[model samples]
Structure formats: C-alpha cells, structure tokens
Target: MSGRQAVPSVRGKPGWLRRLDPLTKGIWLLCTGLAVMLTLSLTAQLLWYLVVLILAGTGAGWRLKQWRLFALWAMGFGLPLLLFQWLMLPVGGDEPLWQPFGSGGPALTASALELSAALTLRSMTLFASSIVYATTTEPRDVVVALTQQLRMPDKLAYAAAVALRFVPLLLAEAEQIRRAERLRRLTPVRGVGGRLQSARRMALAIVRSALRHVQDVSTAMEAKRFGSARARTHWRRVAISPAGWLFAAASIGAAAATLVYF
Candidate 1:
C-alpha cells in the first residue's frame, strides 16, 4: 500500500435512521433485492435503485463522498456483468444494436443490451441497498435482533456479530502488513508475473494472520463460556416502534408493487 492514500471517512448527518431497527432494514434489503432479481425488469430495477438512493441520501443523510463510493462500487461490480451480458449472451433473431470495433464479429443486439441493462441494474440495486443498510445499522444491533427477535441460535448470532466486527480489524491489519513490507523496502512488482507472485505472498500472509486471529477469538470465547447459558440477557434492548414498522412496510410494499406491475 505504498503510495496508497488514507481514505477519509465521510460522516453522514445524524438522523433517525440510526435508530431504526436493524431487523427491519435487513428485511427491506432482502425483500427488495429478491424482488429485483425475480422480476429482472429493467424499469423496476432502475426505479428500485433510485428509490434506495433517495432513502440513503434523504433519510440517511448521504453526502458527496458516499455518492462517490456508491459509483465506485457500481463500476467495480456492475460494469463487468453488463459487459459480459452484452458481449457473450446469445441473441437469436434480434436486430444488432451495436458492433464491436474489429474483426466484424457477431454484433450486439437489443435483447442482449436489454438483458445486460437488467442484470447490471439488479446487481447495482442490491449493492446500493446493502451499502445503505450497513452504513445505517450497527453490528451489535443486528446481532441483538438476530438473537432476540429472530430467535437465532446464540452461537450463530455471536459468530455473525464477530465476523461483522472483524471487517475493519482485518482491513487495518492488511494495511499494517503492507506498511511493514514497505518499511522493509518491499514494493509491488511492476510486471504481470511479478505482481501475481507478490499478490500470492500477500494473500498467504493475510490468510495465515486471519486464521491465527480466529483461533485466538475462539479460545477467548470458549474460556468465557460465551454460549453456556440456556438463555442470555441482553444489556440493551432494541424495540422497533410502530413508526418504524410503517416505514419498513411502505418500502417493502413499494418494492413488491414494482415487481407486480413489471
């Protein structure tokens, strides 16, 4: 990560979104994502994506940095799917909408283009919804909701919570490893082969470190008898007010209606 710059955290304005039940947000994202995937309708997907954006921007108080992150994520994850669908998906009897620059090969068709757009939109919609949910919800709240409201197994809930909490730690560890390598005068290799070798080395180091960390966590949990109790009491209770339910219902209903109309 030499020459890699530190990313500034873009803090959103404090809002009631932080107070919303994690379970409701989870359900909304799940329902909306599934609806988009099932409908595979370009219009519905686009609309859903826009709706999620508005929710994140207005309700969650998104700013320029968040929007930039959203765009970056879309390009990274959605663009490849779109390109592959357009280039490789078969289009029988459909008129060509585009032709590649060289070799005079099979041209792209309206059907293929439409399919590509649908796939891209579906993926982007899901990704955007996840970003909104994760940014707005807290990990502890999610774990509590899973265990208390959803009646998930205590061990499973704890594991999920720990995994979510590990994300930032793992990222920071990777950065530290990179910095250490740079301190030792190690840098990214220039050529494709060298880069691949460097990547392999880095990956192995990260994986080994992660495994050690996981082992330590497991030992610590076992020592603490984390799941020994038949029933555990939470220090903090999460209650979803009537208003929260109404908000969730409206969002889910809109998504379902979109699917039905499309």
Candidate 2:
C-alpha cells in the first residue's frame, strides 16, 4: 500500500505543502518552533503565526473546518496561560491596570499584558505549526525519509512512525470510551475529585488498549524479521524535490530574519 493509504489521519487532496518530502516539512516545523521560541516581540510572534496560517490555508488547503479545532485548542490553552501570566506572575510594572482587592491582590499592569500576549502568541504559533505538519505529513513517509535519507536506524524510525500514527488512534479510542460510558448512562463526574477519578479510569483503559495494539505490532514485526538486516530497503522512496529545497531555504531565511530582527 502507498504511504498515504497507510495513515488515515493524513487525508485530503495533496497540496503544495503535502507534496514536500517529510524531511523538508520536518525542517520547516523545527525552524518555525525555534523562531517562535527565540522571538520576544509580540508583533513578531503574531506575524509568525499569521505566516503559518497563510501557509496552511494556501499551501496545505486548510479551510475553516480545519482551523476550527485548532482555534479551539489555541484558545483553550492560550487564554488560561495569558490570564495566569497577567494575574499570578510577578513580572510587570508597578502601575496597576486593575487592582481587584485593595492595594496588593494580583493587579494587572501594562507590562504584564505585553509579556502575557507575547508568551501566549509564541505558544499558539508553535501549536498551529505542529498541527499543520502533523496533518500534512504522512507517518510512513516520515519513516522512509528518516531511515533512507537521514540514515537513522530502522527500528528507531519505525518507532517514530508508530508513535505518529497511533497518537490520533489513541485519542479516538479515548473518545469512544467516553461515548460508551455516556451511552451506558454513567453519571457525569461533578467536582474536581470525581473528574480526576473518571479521567484516571479512562486513561487506564486507553493504556491497556494501546499496550495490546503495541503487542500485536511487535509480533508482526518480529514475524517479518524486522531489524534483522544491517541494511534496510524502503517500500517507498522519498526524495527532496527542488521546491522542497527552496521551501527549506526560505524557512531558514525567515527564521534567521525573525531571530535577528525580532
């Protein structure tokens, strides 16, 4: 089967971003992550995130549907972090924007707002870039590129591929477990303690399922004599196209510019 067929998560028609070799997309992700980490300016961080969104929209064919989940995730985590930084963190100016409880109870300030915004934007950028890479790149192609082009060990490369492929499966499985519980008329967990118990039970179930699947995969690999040979042959050959090279170079240049200018 083709690499694309092996992973159902990598759906949708191929686009410019999806056509690039896994190595090239990996490099782009790495560069984007590093650039976001090194960037301190809020404006620069926002620009980087916008550039990633544009790439996802134009190159990866991402639409409102694709962005909906991403937006939810970004806001779910970003807003809390932003508020935490602004309220709890002790890294802001003395001029209080809003003193909630008299003189000294988590007063908001301009510097706090700026710092929180930058940090939140940086996190959101990394999150969005990761989603783009994971959605566009195929797990089997990642294995091929790593083992063939990067000369990584076949065992290690396959492990990485399995990780990439199983994450979504595990998530779906957890959701299914939740739905099953709901269908059985299980009472919804109320407080923090009850929620933690429910979560713990769900995690245990997922872990057990994942372990069983891993055992099956291990058995199949052993039957095939995986990692027996010093040299490995890939079913699919992955090579960097000229466009991939250009994309890598452009990403590196942009990362450099972000580091230096911002």
Model 1 stretches with alpha carbons more than 4 Å out: 1-13, 61-66, 101-104, 167-209
Model 1 clashing residue pairs (backbone): none
Taken over the whole model, the C-alpha lDDT of each candidate is 0.74, 0.81
TM for every model, in the order presented, reads 0.79, 0.84
Model 2 lDDT tens row, 139-219:
999999998889898888999888877765675576677767767765666998988888798899999999998999999
How far off is residue 69 in model 2, in Å? Answer: 2.4
Cα deviation of 93 in candidate 1 (Å)?
A: 1.9
